[model samples]
Target: MTLLTVRRDGEIAVVTLDNPPVNAISEAVRKGLYEMVGHLDADPEVKAVVLICAGRTFLAGADVSEFGKPPVEPHLPDVVDRIEAAEKPWVAAIHGAALGGGFEIAMGCRFRVAVESAKVGLPEVTLGVIPGASGTVRTPRLAGVEAAVDLVTGGRPMSAGRALKTGLIDAVVSDLESDAVAFARKALGADLPVPASKRPLDQMPEEFWQAALKSASKAGHQAPLRALDSLRFATENGFAEAMAHERETFLDLRGSEEAAALRHVFFAERAAPKPAALKGVEPRPFRTVGVIGGGTMGAGIAGACREAGMEIILIERDAEAVARGLDNMGKIFDGAVKRGKLTQEGRAERMAGVRGSTDYAELAQVDLVIEAVFEEIGVKRAVFAALGRVCRSDAVLATNTSYLDPRAIAEGLPNPERFIGLHFFSPAHIMKLLEIVPTPDTAPDVLATGFALGRALNKVPVRAGICEGFIGNRILKRYRAEAEALVIQGVPIAEIDAAMRDYGFRMGPFEAQDLGGLDIAFLQREGARAAGQEVPETLGDTLVRAGRKGQKTAGGWYDYAEGDRTPQPSAAVTELLAGWTAGSLDLPRTEIAERLVGAMAAEGQAILDEGIAQTPQDIDLVEVHGYGFPRWKGGPMFATGAS
Candidate 1:
């Protein structure tokens, strides 16, 4: 008697979308829902329908595989329309994540009920599209225009509480399906509930719209403005007109090179390699980790380990250094709590897992020891020698050296196969990328363990060969050197920065140099020079020599004043640069920017040619995550189509 299973209890009929994984809205699911809705509409027995999905998630989005293909006979939009026009009251039960088209489907229902842990968003922007199925129109009607604009444009997900506060959902339910059915039944028994389409538009004041536009402009770029405009069309016109506008804008934007590049980056990040050589190898479980040294890198690495639920032992040479490291870590956790990212209880729990020590013997029972001590070869070797004798034979030994040979560090270790490199970026917990370096002597299982640990810590681990600075920083050195040479050729640092920023870099080369501090690079260059390596004399050295050490010193390539972090071009630095290259041919600022891009692209290609990197996509991933390459334009390689 039921085309779709009608397991009715009282007045409620649970219409479950029986799809796997993230319940993607496929053609079959759409057809099934349409037929089920017809049966439910005719049956006087069922007064209300509860729409739910069976999977880890309610619904992820549209089936991406259907993209660019011929449309199915009955599209998901048509199915959503049928649900919206249904005579019986309906409630959507959301669990896990309801995103993109999935969210649109929920929007079409009379009301939505979400679990406490559920997340919701219209993340179509990330996939290079706008929500084509009334999402652009209805979301703004439910939530305010500004809220909808931010969510859709940023493509960021919101927690259940935030969604409820924004009125994206009617209620936060503990048992999503049961509560949804109860709500639907109650609504049916009371009075006919108003459909989402019949709901009056939540109009935005003209002043509010203007203010939002101003704020979005200050935030910079074109996407936010586009989102605002789309919402405006939805609010001003009707839903049908807004949908047509959404489709047109989506198609136009989707075909753009920028969108294509961004799509490439999205896939490229997911393609981050897990070596086949380490397959089926089990990682050793570690409950406790010991970090040798209490320097910035060491402390940051310790913080990252502690954040991942591992007990940490931070050992420094003296009590003062240990106190400073602990204080810094405390400040970091406090900042996290202030940002509302970590609750006080969570922060306390994470802090309790870490312990500081001065004795190396404390590492005796630790499962993994990461030596973030001084980058000196002898210092690392000596620490490894001591650890080899003291720690368990099965414990993995790791070094945090940026450009040192792991093989040389493990030379006298009891088991060289257990030693590897687990390079964490600065402010370790924040940066998502970890370069995992392995020597030939390192066992496959040890390498596998490093990758697994990285995953557990929510870091993308890339397999890197033993080289100077591995992949990211090594290529960065070349790119920065090229930018620096232009400064020596009478090109102003500000001009270079402006050019790169205009070219879609978040910050210009000299601006980034100023922000990162002139001292770090100056000190690094000195070390390279001392090692008989030819050090490139870039603008950084000139600024450092002039006592311009960046924002801390209130001057670098630019002058800074109190309460003003903005950079003002230094006249003296300009005079110095002009004198440094008196006979060199003067070039235009635009040309310098072009040259910088060329240099980055060329170096990326060279790295690929040398097999130093696995793919051009790997280089792109490094640039995007590690170097702050603009996400919308994708990574550098993909942006320029260098590969």
Candidate 2:
């Protein structure tokens, strides 16, 4: 039946929207609302109206499925207009999230009330479009220009408290729907009520708007700049003009290539939580976890577990190592506190959940054990053997290996079925990618537990079969090989990085290595060579041997000044490299970029071909989240049309 119902809450008529999950604004909902608002405006018996959604949240946003479709009977803006122009004043009750068009509908109401935990924003910029339903025009009026710029440009939701202070919401009460009814009754007492659409905001300095527009373009996203344009139009023109401009800009960006790519990733991320095989299987219990070693990777893993509210037993080689690891974990929490991401009290609570010890015996009580020691096969096997000796027989054992084989690490284990690989990218606590790798011998429940752990940690988990480097790194190897080959042939190193950046990556490969240190990739190459594996002979080994270990050392492929991380093409580096000049090897930037991305795409397809990954989405998730392949480009697979 109808998604909207008008019920009498005493003097106030409560219009409840009942769509399961987040009540997205659909065509049927709009048609129903348009007719109901007309009826309510005609009915003299109704004093005021209170609009609230049933279930956990208000309308989250527009129906995404409606995107790119022909316009329906009642557009969101027209529906909002009808609601606002009603004879009786309308009050909106907001809880959970009122985002994008959802927030726009709330803004259309004369007054709004919300629960303390409620959040609202125009987050359409995140999906690569400005608000099409006059959200941009009204936001600056509801809140001042500064607040509007902060909310729209950042595309972050504002808490109810902030919304109240910024004049976006009138009140925050304990009970949402009833408080909204009370708010509606109180609004009816006003001498004159004004709809939000007719409201005007004070003007800001031209520099403010100019700076916002500049930042939007510099940020490399089209929506924010267009959002600024809409706000500017609202400041200069009237409501109707500004709304028209906003809608036109929204439609333009909605059909843009960047928007299409971003939408692909938006849908991909939503569908990546569970793979096809683990759809019906229940994940094994994973409350407490044991993390072996206390180095950077180990401490990051422990920090992630602790942040997830899991009790952690962080084991190291000795008491000193344990202390160091504990210190590292504390530092990570301290950084979080400094960044306002965690309170001091919250950091203390998280730290309290973790215990530092040199004993493997402490792992007996944990539900899972993740070994995050040195990424050597011998070292990883030794750690697992110790875990096998001390851990519970049923506890899931996993390795944080990037390239090594999991089956080799699981060799001679007491319960080979319990062993799996959880290849977390560097800065493990912060990074989102968790490659949930399973050996052929790994049990279903155990593999599901790995995926569960990734979900609990708020990481993107991609199921991968045992292989040389798995999906991400295998593709990365090929990409890097191509990069080095390009540079060696004739492409300038800086030009190569800038080319990739132009393609929408945050940083190029050479730039990322400086921050992560070049030694690791060097070691990986040398290790592969010693093992009789075919390894590309890049300029990295020579650079490392010359004491150019990257950002930590202030130089690698690119030179850096003291305390500054900007990469300046190095003269010394150029002098050392033979045949790196224009005469030696030169190619078009596009050719280089295509070669890099194309190689990555081919390797990714090969991984799928070899049954190393279940689906293209899995490989795309690994590259996008783990490897920093541009999300707006929908990862390399989607970029290559392989997806």
Candidate 3:
């Protein structure tokens, strides 16, 4: 079937885009649109043109499948330009998502109407580019400079209501296509609003302009900064020149390292959740969930579930602990509201979905029960045993253990197939990564449920097989080990951190550990030792044992004096290391970084070799999203050539 078709209805021609899924502005669709526009313009029977789409969404964006390839004729820019220059007025009937180039096309229309649920924006910044094809130029002309900057740089689509308020759309309609047809007739019957390209920019205070530039600058991403510059250019230059600049900036940034890295993330995130075995399986449905702890991780997990509109029951040791856990969950949403991340109504709805319980029997009605208690094997097994008895036989029983063997934890359970690991990183509600660890005997649908939950909570899920630390922490262990090896070989901790920062890591290993608390690693080490497993010793353990538990305790790996957490070289640590008589090998910063990253890559290879992780990209994603491994480097696996 043709990608685009036009049907003339008396004085108005209704053009429909028939692309499946989100109608991507492909070469064929653009050519078809261009031809239809020319045909309708000369027919004389058509007074105005109505552009709408079929099958799910309107033009969502460009056909990303054509990236990094040879260019074809009738590019999106050319099509949108024709749209702007059309003699007959064009009306855009937007529904679902009209984002990136899709929104740009809508902006090219003379008057736009959309369904109430429609969303529109220039979201190119998220893919590491600015809106090409005059979106930056036209959006500012129609929506004013501030809204343009926000819509373009922020890369979030505005709902139809917000779009109407911002003047991005003419009206919010009930029947998208029919209303747009009526809108075209009514519009042609009156004095037309000027085309978006001809509209002037709104004047703003000097501080507002400065503030916009400052916000983009502070974002630390090149795409947003470029978007800000393009919007700013629209104010200073003519519409045509600013549109030229927009196309130029987009093409310039499209091949950039940052853009490439972001695209890698975009694609990797899209592919990460699916495992080979569960390819055809459907996830079991779930409503109410039971969380078996009210500590930080439990509260965060419960908060995330509540945020996903899932009913939650949090289990704690007693009434006071349950109250505290619920209190912590409340504080999280309260903070979200205070920060403008959540509306008061949203907070109230999420809070209302959550309740506290001291009884395991209260979990009988829950569809899924996750144990987010202390990451101890025995404690987790005991929780599962109780869960096995209380929860329905088919309900998923998940352990939130970071490193313990999930298979062993399910040993006592009657239905081992339902037991799996939903390893959420610390500050779980905010973090995006969720490692879905499934034991060998885990039911396919049960495994699918873990991924399903990750989606519900808006997290990136990677399926991992049974292993201590799964994918992220396993590789992180190697990175940490290598860092300690550097410190032991007479590399100053401060110099090591500086080298890693230069290598694009947000913070060096030691600094991150200190921030995460040194006590965490110490406890893990001691736990393994008590279980008769030989754990590699790190300098962090010694420091933790020395009452230097890091940031919370005012110091670890470095000094934090008074009100400063600046991480100065500690004389006490210097004395301790010097007294311990470590071996000397003065390594340069570059060499130190290479050896550390190499060690991590080696461990990642070992993980893949052992089938601990399903794919190299999975390993890369874990390091990138979970551990702050530089996205620009494309994860350790790609950077190290181990993928």
Candidate 4:
């Protein structure tokens, strides 16, 4: 009498979704759910049903492989409808993440219980779809419309505490399966749990909703606006009517080229760097590490090492510099504690693993050493040369250089094979990317160790071959050059930034430059120009000459008023660019934006063609992780189909 393992205790039955990994909602899973629900509804012995999945996660989401294909018979939506309309009480026991269609399926149940560590979200907007399976309609009913708007628009997952506060689930259980079964049995004897369909629509005070919409509009991202519209429909109409509207919107969005491109990017990121080289290569165990230099990058590297549970020795040129680095590190730990991300005890424990010193002899026994010193080639080469003489022969010597060639830095080292590049992004502990650059003489074991260290640091390790600026910076150089060209052609910096922001970048090139500082790019431009390379005419030079460095000085390409971070167009900058281009071609602002996109995409394509990047996905991952490129639009190459 068992369709897929029917086990009943008294009047309650447990129906498990026996799918592996994320328990993605596939056709077979849908059919199994429908058949099991029907069996439970008809059985006299079973008065209630508890639906749960057998895995770390309840349901990760839809099977991405099944997207864009014709619907299989008895689709997941139909199966969910059957469960929702069932006469018997049904409880959903969730652990891990319940997202997209998975969350919708949970909403269909009469009751929901989740573990304290469980996470839930709709997140369909990330894949360019509104939650088509009634999630857009139901989530707002549980959490208010504003919360729903934030979650669906941002595609952020919430913790069990947040879920409980929002009324998304009935209870947060210590033991998901047992507690869910008990809840189901108790519900069968008592009244049915409040059905999602019966819940009142979320109502915000008129002023709040108006303000929320206005804020979302100011964000200027399309997905947020679309998510807001879906929530609006749900509030105005009933659940069923809103669901119908959601379906239409989903279909329209799914057919868009942008959506297809975004989806392509999603899969490409997963396939970015092949693990083939990592096969059969075992990583070295790193219990302690030495970090040279006490600047921002060094402090960030020390924070990352300590965060990974590795004991660290922070080395600086002098005692005072070392004290400053340790102080900065403490500030970072304090901020983490204040944000509730770390307990006081946890922060203390992490900080305890880090020590400061000014002596080179202190690094003799560490497993690895990362040089985060100044970007000068001579300084880095000298550091490696000294490290080679002082450290163990097998110790991995890494240079945290953004653009300098690793092979050149390793030239005079005694053991060049152990030297490589570990380019950690700014605020290394926070950013997710670590570009692992290997020179021709770099040992396979060293590469393996760098990759392992990246995983240990909870970073996405990408293998990049040695180039002038490696992968991310190499492509970024082109994009920056294009922005400068557009400026020379008479486009306002503010307008160019706005267009890129509308296209889904977190910030425009000029905005990023202003925040990062105009002086930062001056050295790189000078280097390029000194090498007889044609320099793109950038308004950055004009600003730098005028002593308007950036936000630190309150002026660059844009002006920042006192106590304000918002950038306003600088008349001085506009006049400089206008005077420079007065005798040249006058280009429209829109054309400048279009050219910027074209140049970036073209440069990305050229990188792939030249074998600098392994695949189009690799380029995308570099942009997404290294830069603040928007994930929803995919990478530059993915957007342009340059791959």
1 or 2: which has the higher lDDT? 2
Off by over 4 Å in 1: 1-6, 67-73, 217-221, 273-279, 536-539, 542-546, 562-564, 582-592
> Candidate 4: worst 10 consecutive residues by lDDT?
581-590
Following a full C-alpha superposition, what root-mean-square deviation does model 3 have from the true structure? 2.3
Local lDDT at 587 for model 3 = 76
Off by over 4 Å in 2: 579-586
Q: State each model's C-alpha RMSD to the native.
A: 2.9, 1.8, 2.3, 3.0
Q: What does candidate 4's lDDT look like per residue over 1-643, in tens digits?
A: 1224556777888887767767888888778888878778889788888888886889788888888887686876677788888888788899999998898899888888999999999887777667877777888887778778787877789998898898888899998888999888777778665677768885667787677678666544455567778888889898778878887888788777757766876776455333676789877668889999878889888998888789999998888999999987887888899999899999999888899998888989999999999888889988887898889898899999998878888888887888889999998878888899888888898889998898788787788877777888887878888887766665667778887886767889988988988887788777778879898656678778788888989988788999999999887776766766543455565566567767877877877777776777777778888887777657777766675
- The clash count of every prediction, one per candidate, is 0, 2, 0, 0
* Model 3: lDDT of residue 535: 81
Model 4 spans > 4 angstroms off: 1-4, 218-220, 525-548, 558-580, 584-588
Q: Residue 66 CA error for candidate 4 (Å)?
A: 1.4
> Could you tell me which residue pairs clash in candidate 1?
none
- Pairs in steric clash, model 3: none
lDDT of 3: 0.85
Q: Please, what is the whole-model Cα lDDT of each candidate in the order they appear?
A: 0.79, 0.86, 0.85, 0.81
Whose TM-score is greatest here?
2
Tell me, by lDDT, which candidate is best.
2
Each candidate structure's TM-score, on Cα atoms with residue i matched to residue i, is: 0.92, 0.96, 0.94, 0.91
- CA deviation > 4 Å runs, candidate 3: 202-210, 341-345, 579-593
Using TM-score, rank the candidates from best to worst: 2, 3, 1, 4
